[model samples]
Target: MNNKRFVILASIAALGLSGCAGYREKRGFILDEQLSQAVQVGTDNKTSVERTLGRPTFTGQFNDNEWYYVSRSTSTFAFRTPRVIDQTVLRIRFDPAGNVTAVERTGKDKIASIDPYGRTTPTLGRRKSFFEEFFGNIGTVGSGGLPGGGGQ
Candidate 1:
């Protein structure tokens, strides 16, 4: 009986530890090197561009000749609190002849054009809670004492 209990307990602990086994590395964008090699007009082809870099996130809606490579790195903790570290958008335009016509990079400095509104305005920060403002966190965690009782 003692050995059986020990084995069960060990198995449970091992299972718990296994859940945390996937160690994710700190991901970041290596954009500087890639951006330096500008897409020369009337030289780079679509196939060659894709081979050199990677698939573009977006293609121009009105025209099929334009390509946009949007690269961004976001980080979050236990909760999904996102923090954008780096963002780079490389816009490549192709001529009627299907060769690279223009290439421009839009980074932090040129982000204003991306969003006409620019940065989000800061609120007063005094946010009204769901419970306090509406119902409230009055009852305990597992308690079934609220208005709509036994649903969960």
Candidate 2:
């Protein structure tokens, strides 16, 4: 009986400790390292760009001619503040024939220079409350809880 109890307690302790394991994932955008060399003026084609840099993160709608390769790193500690560590954007422009015209790389340095105040006034729509977004409807029963609702 004592051995069985010890086994059960040990199992429970193991499970509890495992629950504290860190949760991490690759976050944000990251541009390919070869992008700088692969993309060049009047040399790269659509197929070549796709092959060299992989699929772009974003492509322009107005022109479908521009591609944006972006990469970002987000770190989070349990019960601690989460932050973005690095971000990079590679912009590739194509001509009417879908041939690469120019390639530009932007990084943290560009961001800092572009937004020194870190407060670019929005000229857009209204922003919703955090609780309303996370909990949906606070008054609704079985709805209000957390951002990702309970489910298996």
Candidate 3:
């Protein structure tokens, strides 16, 4: 009887401990401390940087002078939304000659948590009910309601 009790307790404990495990995910550039440190300003150009750190997560929106390497890790428990556990944004800026001019490293402190402004966005015009929105455009179309419709 005591052996049976002990077995049950051990099984329950094992199951409880397993429930605490969370799923972890890593995405984007996998930063290596040595490789990242190897890149030197004025010494490393686009080609060297690419050899050292691989392709950047993205380049500057307007130009190629700036490159960004981003690393992020997220963890999710059960069915909950994944939460960022770690993040790194390495920004390397190059001069017109393609030589690295600066290297900036940022951590999770740079991450932004944005909460949407509720389900619906406030619009400028007016609010209408479901029925109004459904039937509002019924008779408005094909009658020159549009500028170039030329409806008769």
Candidate 4:
């Protein structure tokens, strides 16, 4: 009996440990150093860039000349919020004729931290209490009767 109980407890502990193991996920474009290096400014055009790096994750909203390749790795353990382990943003600028003009790379150092002020957002309207809202429309709604009801 003692040996059986010990074995059961050990198995449970092992299962729990396995459940706590962290998982890493890669999101967005996969960047290869060789492929990226193959692109040359003023020489590689839009077609060549697409052939080398595939489609970009996103293009500049106002202008299509700027292409962005984004890659991120996130890690999560159990139910905890996933944390960004690594991130890279590659920006390729193209001229009006669609020739590559410049290439830029950004990493995790560019990430920004923004903290929200509060749970509620301020709005532009009269505030009413629960009781006021529940009863405020009680008299106004039926006083005039339903539209086109024709008073009998």
Candidate 5:
């Protein structure tokens, strides 16, 4: 009985530990060290870059001169918010002639934290209470002697 109880307890502990193990996921572009290294600044052009690194995750907001390769690894334990464990952003800039001008790399250190001030946006209008808003439009949206109203 003692040996059976011990085995059962150990099994339970193993199950609990497995349940607590975090899940990791990779998001976005997959970076290949060898392929990335093959890109040469001032030597490779847009076609070569695309051949070496495939299509970019995104291009510059305003122009196509800049290409970005973004990758992130995130882990979540149970119900906790997913946290980034590793991130890489590769930026390739091209000259007007399409030759690679520069190659830059950024890591998780560049991640930005943003906090919104409030849930509601301030607008140019009078504030109305819940009851006022609920009843305010009730009587105004009827066909009652107005130009568009069917009643004459």
Candidate 6:
């Protein structure tokens, strides 16, 4: 009976520890080094590149000639926000003839973190309490009416 209780407690502790373990996740297009390297500028066209590296993650906003293959790896511990550990943005640019013009790659140096200000957002207007806002518009609604429009 003691052994059984010990086993049960140990199992529960193991599961709890597992929940606290850091989790790593691979998101978006997972690039293959060899496959990505095989794509050569001036040699690989749209069709060939597509066949070699699969479809791109997304195309350029303005033109379809530029393609972006983005890969990111993230890690999260417990209940924290997932942080990017590895990032790769491979941009393949094509010319008018659809041949690869340039191959560019960017790493995690481009990642940006934005933290909002405080619990309340700062606005352009003066701050007012709840009751003030609820009753503030009562007198202002009729303040702009015509002076001589008193129902003749």
Clash totals in order = 1, 5, 0, 0, 0, 0
Clashing pairs in 5: none
Full ranking by TM-score: 3, 4, 5, 6, 2, 1
- Model 3 lDDT per residue over 1-152, tens place: 99999999999999988987889999999999999999999889999999889999999999889999999999999778899999999999999999999999999997778999999898998889999999997766666758546565
Residue pairs with backbone atoms closer than 3 Å in model 3 (clashes): none
- Put down candidate 2 lDDT per residue, 19-119, tens digits, no spaces: 66555555545555765575778888999888887788889988799998877776666556556667778889998899988888777566543445556
What TM-score, computed on C-alpha atoms, does each candidate reach? 0.48, 0.53, 0.81, 0.80, 0.74, 0.72
**Predicted candidate 1 versus true structure: per-residue lDDT over 1-152, tens digit per residue:** 99999999999999876765432233333455644385567778887777776667779999999988776766555445455666777888888777888888886555443444557555686776666766665554456764566535
Q: What lDDT tens digits, residue by residue, belong to model 6 across residues 1-152?
A: 99999999999999989878888999899899999999998899999999999999999999999999999999999999999999999999999899999999999999887898999889898899999988986655445563544332
lDDT of model 1 at residue 36? 38
Q: Of the candidates numbered 1 and 6, which has the greater lDDT value?
A: 6
Candidate with better TM-score, 2 vs 5: 5
lDDT of 6 at 117: 95
Instruction: For residue 138, give model 6's deviation from the true position in Å.
Output: 9.2
lDDT computed for candidate 2: 0.75
- Candidate 6 has which clashing residue pairs, if any? none
lDDT of 1 at 101: 81
